[model samples]
Target: MPAEKKAYPLRISATVLEAMQRWADDELRSVNAQIEFVLRQALHNNGRLKPAKVKPLTDDDTR
Candidate 1:
């Protein structure tokens, strides 16, 4: 299963929102997803979130 995402209400100026919308469209992502992607990148760049570890799965693990 994928990790769940949390939602929070955000307030921003119209100018910024418009800019984000344009960037999101250019990147082929929804506005909400684009925001999350940018925020995650920022956190990762600042060393706040360590890269997730990927482990090979066995048949039992899948079950």
Candidate 2:
């Protein structure tokens, strides 16, 4: 199954935006994907990522 998706609006300084775009390109990801990946990593590192709310009936949801 595909991952669920959501949209968010953000504001940042031009310098930060430029740096993020360059980093995203270097990582071979779109800016949005890179941002999401970084945020997920940070959340996991800080032990802030919540567990899945719904239990899976099978292995499919585990991925």
Candidate 3:
């Protein structure tokens, strides 16, 4: 599935930003992609991602 993206501004210290740039270079990903990858990884590690809920069919929709 294709992922959705939104543009947002961020503030970070130069030290952290430089470290992230170097990390992104090593991973061959844009700095923004690298940041998203790291965040998703952290969320998965902590079991923060929840499965989507499914809705049951209702009589009204049967038409």
Candidate 4:
């Protein structure tokens, strides 16, 4: 099952938000997704989140 997501209201300065919007556009991600991506990366770098393990694909998996 996918993890459940909870929404939280955020307040930010206009300058920062505009910058994030441009960065998000460059990455082809919505602002929310860009924020989440940055937060997740920060958590992983700080050892607060564990890295995800991806299973190796096999011949049958490609079918």
Top-scoring candidate (TM-score): 4
lDDT of 3 by residue, 1-63 (tens): 445788999998999999999999999999998998888888878999754466779999898
The candidate, 3 or 4, that scores higher on lDDT is 4
TM-score of each: 0.78, 0.71, 0.72, 0.81
| TM-score of candidate 1 to 2 decimals | 0.78
Better lDDT candidate (1, 4)? 4
Task: Report per-prediction Cα RMSD to one decimal.
Answer: 4.1, 5.1, 9.2, 2.4
Mind sharing the TM-score for model 2?
0.71
lDDT of 2 by residue, 1-63 (tens): 566897789998899889889999999999888888888888988999964467458888667
- What lDDT would candidate 4 get against the real structure? 0.94
Model 3 misplaced stretches (Cα beyond 4 Å)? 50-63
Candidate models: Cα lDDT each: 0.91, 0.85, 0.87, 0.94
lDDT (C-alpha) at residue 62 in model 4? 100
The predicted structure with the larger TM-score, 2 or 4, is: 4
Look at candidate 1 and tell me the lDDT of residue 54: 87
